[model samples]
Target: MNIIFEESPKEVADSATGFDLFQDRSIVAIKVNDELRDLSHKLSDGDTVIGVSIDSDEGLSILRHSAAHLMAQAVQEIFDPAKLGIGPPIKDGFYFDFDVEEPFKPEDLKKIEKRMKELVGKSQRFVRREVSDEEARELMKNEPYKLELIGLKSADVGEGAAEVGAGTLSVYENINPDGTIAWMDLCRGPHLPNSRTVGKSFSLLRSAAAYWRGNENNKQLQRIYGTAWPTQEQHDAHLERLEEAAKRDHRKLGVDLDLFSFPEEIGSGLAVFHPKGGVIRRVMEDYSRKRHEEAGYEFVYSPHITKSNLFEISGHLQWYSDGMFPPMKLDAEYADDGTLKRQGQDYYLKPMNCPFHILIFRSRQRSYRELPLRMFEFGSVYRYEKSGVLHGLTRVRGMTQDDAHLFVSNEQLESELTNVLDFVLGLLRDYGLNDFYLELSTRDPENPKFVGSDELWERATSTLESVASASGLQLVPDPGGAAFYGPKISVQARDAIGRTWQMSTIQLDLNLPERFDLEYVGSDGERHRPIMIHRALFGSIERFFGVLTEHYAGHFPPWLAPVQVVGVPIADEFGDYLQKFADELRSHGVRIEVDHSDNRMQKKIRDHTMAKVPFILLAGARDQEAGTVSFRYRDGSQENDISLADARIKILKAINDKTQV
Candidate 1:
């Protein structure tokens, strides 16, 4: 058997064959075909090993990881620091933590970044050396955190795991060509050959205070964040995207538009919609209700707060208590005190609508006739999100979900899932989002946090995969991304600006059914478990509204516009004509307004345009005499002297077709 070792000069094994050594030391990531594994994993013949460089995404991660090391090294060089903390690679970036004299300032960041660049230019070589655990502890004497890491490493390599043979634990020293070592880090690395390989595609982002290892009770350390890319162009493009993202920030837009606000007295993550915002929300919900009704869906409602026992049976209380609002306490008399007491006394604000929907389904004994029961609700849920993590409507503590659950037989699972996916895709398309991708989130066999048996998980996951395949969806699999109860198919939609947002999800759950004891009588006359498919086309109404606002730049489509049309009169003499025209449009269920606030025609037109009203109907004595009204659109297109009826027809058609004007 061949035993793999990272950066080892020679391979030691029970029985060895011809050893094939990698030629280049710049291999940042070593993967076996599609699977990414740590570089220390063993390899055998016929293994297709792909070497990652500084140009690939994985390569950038490795570079960023090394850059984090460089940051740590630089901080150590400048400040005779107190304690070290963990530094790891994150999405598009890396971060390192340190206990310092005070919070790091912007100027200090500039100096640290400059020092990092200098170290990169020096092209320090990384040399790996193996040492025993006792020796490692002795070497890392100054770092108490390192000593703790050493202990964890010892535990990981202890007992039954030792049968795999204890591989050499090593540290890498950054050395100069003159044979003097620049600096070193205790690591188990297959790092890039030199500091220069980290490339110029790196930048220090920001600093934040974090617990030493993410535990709140632990001492806080200042974390410095940085981003790395494969090339200068990619880096610049990313930075530009970040700038655009900042400009498109919904919080800023919400304030500027006066759509929503969160007062300090009102608390965080709970926004109060302004009149304009309420108007917009009303229009959106009305449209959704109309469409859903047309599609044969029945709306239902449930209480915002439920008893603690309801969630206890649903397994949410045990697993998701951290994200939930603290349970309301009961008075001593209300509490169970040895004497026989009525149950179901504790209360909780609902975090999800699935359990309530399931309860609705279980309310009656179901049969084969109602094989695929689809129930929908625009249900509002409250999740106590940490204040630090809350950001605008997208990440809110309280929001309404366009949620639904399908109770289908095992035989109907595939077709039902397909239909749900198609419906979700169609809904997103109606909202002008055509580009989308699908992800199949499956359970990790090694992870015990997930509920249900392996057989049930396999069946649920396989059914979802089949449905996705049949739907011809280009699917990607995300292991360990499944919900605690079951697997799911998530839909990610890309907007006009090429920004992707997770909008829809279709999850197949067997665990919840088992937990809730949900079943249906099958054709064979035996009670069988009904596969529960939890779906939410629009993850959250508030979040989707925020996304749509940014997607269209607040220029909503005619059907969804808070005000579809605004009537403008050149002078008070044409006020009657303007009101008459607005009334005609409003009669057809259109949101039309007549400008009678003494604002000029020009100012009215500008106001309507700024508010993103689709069409502006301008009336003047000349147009009124000719039996016409001047029609203009937000995009500055004018249809001068158009008949009022003709203008109304065009606007009605646009609204009916749900077209952006």
Candidate 2:
């Protein structure tokens, strides 16, 4: 009998249990059917496969996931009878869920680390095998979470899921050289070559409680988080970066500086700003409003609550409803009807400001002269954030956005974006944040959440990238970070402590104009849709204020400090003299305070220093006679023997220049 064999590329090799076929020469991992498995899995002819390369994110995820399994295997070796849940890879790391009786103490982590090292030394290999659903269920029956996950497949992907191309599932097992299973997980995995190949590239970071499947209603499971890199040096660098992040944690600084408080009685995620914090926020907003006014932006106001019908048309009801607060039903009695009846009308607190601003633009027909119309508003919006995800002001439920919308022609999009980026960077620098990076977030063609057509998305994304490049900014790609309606450019600022905070965004919108049917009469005498650019320089006033407090370490600059100057008279007699000097400073547009609280001059100075007052002018008989005042800074620098007028001039210059005193 004569057998026919087809010629193929040199990159592929013939495999067993098949006709002429090419082996995965470059694919580090392969997705077989609905499951991800190692490329070593013997493939049948025409098996659906998606190759994963070493440089790809999916490949990295597999490496992290495999690291997580190794961690669990190590824990089981040290602590026998330990229950295991699911271990999945997340952004930049991987976490394993465990149902241990007690929380894994810090000491427990050390022992687990020791065992992991031993396992890495053993140079064990990860083996894979194909198993049916019944076989998988029997193997994972001891693990409730894994069994639950297997159950969720049918539910998560409902009947007629075949339309989505979800086929039957399979499982892979990990085995040791003795052919005894070291550990096994119910996962779709395309892992690394073996334990020895995993390299010295992972570290156990922290452990916390996470609800199963992220559902609070489910039983809470202990989660061990760990990060793995392709190289050991990268892992060490990441650990160092984490240490830097902890130093910039706003919550720690908030307590140290007495800037804000989140009392449990007041509620989680809701914060109360202290006097100092309020002053910082006021100055920030006041200066922002001044700048916006100078830039020809017209201010507008909108109510916090709106009828549900408005959101339904804006597509927020269907897409972002989960992030919004639940609606309240209006009764018939409140609607001018005596009978108590359900009106079937719902009202919701606004979660964003764009829809309201769109209504303003559509209130009247615009003309070509009104092109590039810029409208600004310091709008406060509320979101229903999950308590588990809430942090300090950075992840709050209520905050105000320095929001604006620019209605311009498609031809004006690039210039408008350029101006917005420049304006954002300029204002940020005023607060002493000079370093920045730009992220151009474009639409994901696979995701249907985005509203605009592909053509519009391409035009908007290209325009944003061009503007960012022209501005000489380092643009990074943020896939799937775009808003529901359009792509955006996120401006990330590095603070004084070298920490990055996402404080500004400029988004190009084409969906809203079409939804609202807004148009402007162009020079051609034809009704044309106006391109909208939505931007927020300070993403939120509360969040930015929090970041600023930590960035300055609570020692704000003179111009922005609530109390720019404090006068501490040496004795009771000199209080009157110092009061006059304080009044003079106040008249010069400085926020000055005179301390005569019956405390000693030393005590008063200490109190003012604690409050972070930029300038402290001490007056006594000797200095008062010479018409001079001894000046000091919050940093303990004293410029003695200076005339009061000269001291005032110096203080005013610092405040005017917004310098750190």
Candidate 3:
């Protein structure tokens, strides 16, 4: 029989399986008619089949999924009462949730990993079989979580979708060499052929408590995370990268450098910047303001809270109420007889600044001259983030967004977006983040949460895509990831450690102006609806600060360092000389400090270097006589006998150039 193989016709024997057609051991699975299936799947005449390499994205997912099943079987065997929840492969790893009486300790992971290795060595075959709903229920009767997932087979159950989808029910059996089922799981899988194929490159990472289905209202389940790779070298490389990431953790660096803190009494996700942190933030904002001013952006300010009606008019209350804080009732009046005389109004902390900017645009009538009016603000907004989801500074409840709204005509949409993208990239590069790619997040057609007509969405999405593509940066599609109002292009920046952070977003919004009834007098003498573009360069100041902190590992550049230059005297006598030099630099607006403490000069140098001071000026009797000081940099390199005048110029140049000295 002739069948299409990898887009080409090939002759194969009758009743041949993918295993028989593709004899390569690396081809773990096959795509039959665009659907992933196990290698054991039988082929039909004229069927199109393509091999799924074990190193490809889809192949890795299948390998990890099979690893997840192996780990689950090991867990159940080790812990008799553990009930299974969803086990899905995520980015670079996989996790399985279990309802256990006690949380898993570190030792538990070791045992599970050992059992998995033992199972892998046994070369058990993974056999898939389709069953009816009734049979699935009977097989998974003891697992209440699996039973619940079976009931939600026709619905979208988030991560549990990996287990049960709107299709025929199937289960994977780990068949031992003795022709008996060692274990079984309800899954929609195209897993590896056997346990040995999972390889020794897999490992159990750690365990954490996660709520089932990611809902606080649901029962908490103990989730064991693991990672699998096609080779041991790749697994070791991933572990090394993780170790480096831990060293660069912003929270730890923040505390160690005395930059910021999150006081428990204050809140869960609110961060308080110290004086040092404040210095960096002020410089960042000041530079941004200067750039915006040069770019024809007008500064604006809005209150932190507003009446709930504003959000209602903007469709935030209708579509994004879950993310907004609960409203506060106020301004109600009562009669002396305790009877209601006036109704109360509900006020809420503003979750976004776009609505306020839209109101400002509607406050006045303008002509084509002001059609591309750009309003900028460092607006503080509040969000009601669940406790479990909040991280150190990246995910916070309150943050200040470097937000701007551009009101442009239809003709100005593409150009304005192009300029915005350029401006965002340039500014981010100014802060030492140069590597970037663009992710276009478009609305999901099947989701009801997205507003706006299909025509408007397509126009906005296509225009943004054009702007992004024109910039020559790699553009990735993120379908179903847009905001409710419109599509947005987010700048994903890679930090020093190669981790991507979403730094800036340029959203082309046409629905907000329509909702707010915003208009501008065009050159044709008719009022026309203006298009609103939402742009946030840094996403949020607090989040950006954290990212920069991690990106540089607390060793900020000379321009952004809180204490740029510190003067150290060989003894207490030379303190006055170094102080005079520091005074001269201070006059040039340099953040210089002279250490005249009782500690030795070496101690002060060590202390300041530990604090990540960019430059250390060490003056001694010989240097004082020569009117010169030695330059000690953060990397411990030194320049001896630099004249005071020359040192001043070099220091200023480093600061002005934003060099990582």
Best by lDDT: 3
Across residues 1-661, which tens digit of lDDT does each residue of candidate 1 receive? Answer: 3333343333345332212334554565576545543344456644555556567777776777788878888888987864667777787788887888888899888888899989989898776677887887787788887677666663542221211123656667888878898877677655566788777778898998987656789889999999887678988988998888776777887886778898879788888898878877777787777767776677789999998999999988998999999988654354355763544367899999999999999999999888788888999999999878897899999999988888888778888888888888888888888888899999888988888888888888888898888777688899999998889999988887788898899987777888889988988999998889888877988998898888887788888777788888899888888898788778898899888878877888898888778888888888989999888888899989888778888999998998888
Q: Where does candidate 1 stray beyond 4 Å?
A: 1-69, 82-90, 117-180, 186-202, 211-220, 228-237, 264-266, 327-344, 567-579, 594-606, 616-646
Model 3, span 10-99: residue lDDT tens: 999988999997778999999999999999998988899999999999999999999999999999999989999999999888999999
**Which window of 10 residues has the lowest lDDT sum in candidate 2?**
157-166
Evaluated at residue 654, the lDDT of candidate 3 is 92
Residue 419 Cα positional deviation in candidate 3, in Å, after optimal superposition: 1.3
lDDT of 2 by residue, 1-661 (tens): 1112232222223363221232543345666554555757665554555566544788788777778878888877766566777777777778787888788888888788677767777667676554667876898888776676666654553221211123344555566667777776665555665776555678787899987667779889888888887777778888887777676577876776677898889787778888867777888998999999998899999999999988987878888899999999774443466555556679999998989999998898889789789999999998999887887988898888889999999788888888888988999998888899999998788998888788889888988898999888788999988988899999998887676788899988878789888899999999999999989988888888878877887788998887888888999888888899888887888889889899999999999998778889898999889988898888899988899879878988997887787
lDDT (Cα atoms) of all candidates against the true structure: 0.79, 0.79, 0.93
Better candidate number, 1 or 2, judged by lDDT: 1
Where is the poorest 10-residue window by lDDT in model 1? Answer: 157-166
Order the candidates by TM-score, highest first — what do you get? 3, 1, 2
In the order shown, the candidates' Cα RMSDs to the true structure are 6.9, 8.5, 3.8
Supply candidate 3's per-residue lDDT for 651.
96
Candidate 2: which stretches are off by over 4 Å?
Answer: 1-74, 83-103, 110-205, 210-221, 226-249, 252-258, 262-267, 331-344, 570-573
Off by over 4 Å in 3: 1-59, 101-103, 121-171, 177-179, 187-201, 209-220, 230-236, 326-331, 341-346, 625-628
